[model samples]
Target: MAAVSPREERKARLAEAVWRIIAERGITAVSVRTVAAEAGMAVGSLRNLFSTQTGLLEFSAELMVERAAARVTAITPSTDAVAYALAAICELMPLTPETRREFEINIALIAETPAHPGLARIRDHAHTQLLDLFTRIAAMLRGETAAPSPASRTNGRRLLALADGLGLHLLHQRASDDIGWAVDIVRDELHRIKSAAIGD
Candidate 1:
């Protein structure tokens, strides 16, 4: 393979530095100068790689989601429906140092979604996909034999909202160990729905 471009390597290093700073301090800590300092590069070179502040912020957001996706994909869940689901949900949280930084950067980006034009679309897309994921997890627990209803769709969104809310809370040191709690909540809702059907 061809050698990695110096520019590309520098961009990756700076992105990593931004991620680290965001985790240690906060997203507001991420700036051309700060990241350049962390990466031990001149701000000019960092700017050359990003071209603009928005570009770097946008890249960080994308990288956050990409890292989360990789974490989720590394798991191989059991065939047991609930077991499979809870296992998958475990992947979404910042369980490791690297993932923690990733989550931190994403949370910081969420705060700037309004002021940062680059992050608006990324935030929207991330939420949309997360809800879709919840919807799928709902269907899996319910089984395909039973068609998901309008109420089921609403429930799926609620579950995702809970997960996202808890994510932000944990990022801010407000909530602790939401991963299992979230999975339990979803499973409980599923059972509650089935029970309601049985009584009907």
Candidate 2:
């Protein structure tokens, strides 16, 4: 892998600071000054990286989406489509510490969307990407090598809803300590979809 440039590293550090603040203190606590303090950087340095708090928030949110997407893309396709689908979908859940932090940041950004209308675009874009991922998974579950059909898209939306619900429940219930339950739920759902497809 190529080395990360100093400027890129600094920006990543600042973005991490933003995520930490959002995860720990909520979105309300995120600001140029606070993020600078969290990152142990000067106010001017943080400003040089991000001119405004919205810019900081947007970058952090974008980075979060990018990281999640990268992880999903890295999964090797499996003959067991159900297992492959579960692996990709589970990356979106807060099952691990890293993913839990990302989930918290995601929730915080969504909650602030009303006040920060700019964030709505990022959220919507991420939603579209996720929907597309689910559609592909739906096609895979049906053993279809062709493009996703309208029915596949519909099923994808349902799968997305299920995933969102599961993530929220896990976050609300603090179920990270026992993530097997969520994993089983997803695995069962995938099997059900596969069975339904085979039946049809």
Candidate 3:
């Protein structure tokens, strides 16, 4: 197979550097000059890839999504309900260093972009993705014969809300944040929703 082109390689390196900066300091460290310096290149070189500050920030957000998606997708082939549910839930939690960094960076971006429409766009997009993942887990937890009902879907949304809220709290260190806690919280809520949906 052919190797990646120099330009593509440079952009990839630059993006990775941006991740490192955000992960270590914060998004406040992400600028054309800083990112280029981190990438061991010139500011002009970095700008060749990202034309504007908005573009660079948006690409950083995209990297976060890519990382999150890959983590979530790892469990897609599993048929075990518990494992699948755990996998879905784990996607929201920052269990590893990489995930912790990504979530921290993304949250900082969310905070900084309040005045920009990109904030809502990226935040909503991430929420929608979480909802979809939770919906699938909700389905498995509901049982094979259960159908998707209004109450069930709402329950799915609620589960997503709980997970996101817990994840955010965990990230902020304002709550007792642990993987086990996140799992228990999700499972308990999933049970309530499933039982109510099927009238058990």
| Top candidate when judged by TM-score against the true structure | 2
Candidate 1 structure lDDT: 0.71
The candidate scoring highest on lDDT is 2
lDDT of candidate 3 over 101-168, digit per residue (tens): 77777777788767667766877798787777677667667774456655557767888778768777
In order, candidate lDDTs are 0.71, 0.89, 0.74
- Global lDDT for candidate 3? 0.74
lDDT of 2: 0.89
Q: Which digits, one per residue and each the tens of the lDDT, describe model 2 over residues 32-71?
A: 9999999999999988888988888888889889999999
Q: Candidates 1 and 2: which is better by lDDT? A: 2
Model 1 steric clash pairs: none
Candidate 1's residue-wise lDDT over 35-152, tens digit each?
Answer: 8899898988887788887898788787777667766677786677666665666567554455555666677778898889779998888878777777777666655446666655
Which regions of candidate 2 deviate over 4 angstroms?
none
What C-alpha RMSD separates each model from the true structure?
3.7, 1.3, 3.1
TM-score of each: 0.78, 0.95, 0.83
Please identify model 3 stretches exceeding 4 Å from their true place: 1-6, 144-147, 172-178, 197-200
Question: What is residue 153's positional error in candidate 3, in angstroms?
Answer: 1.6
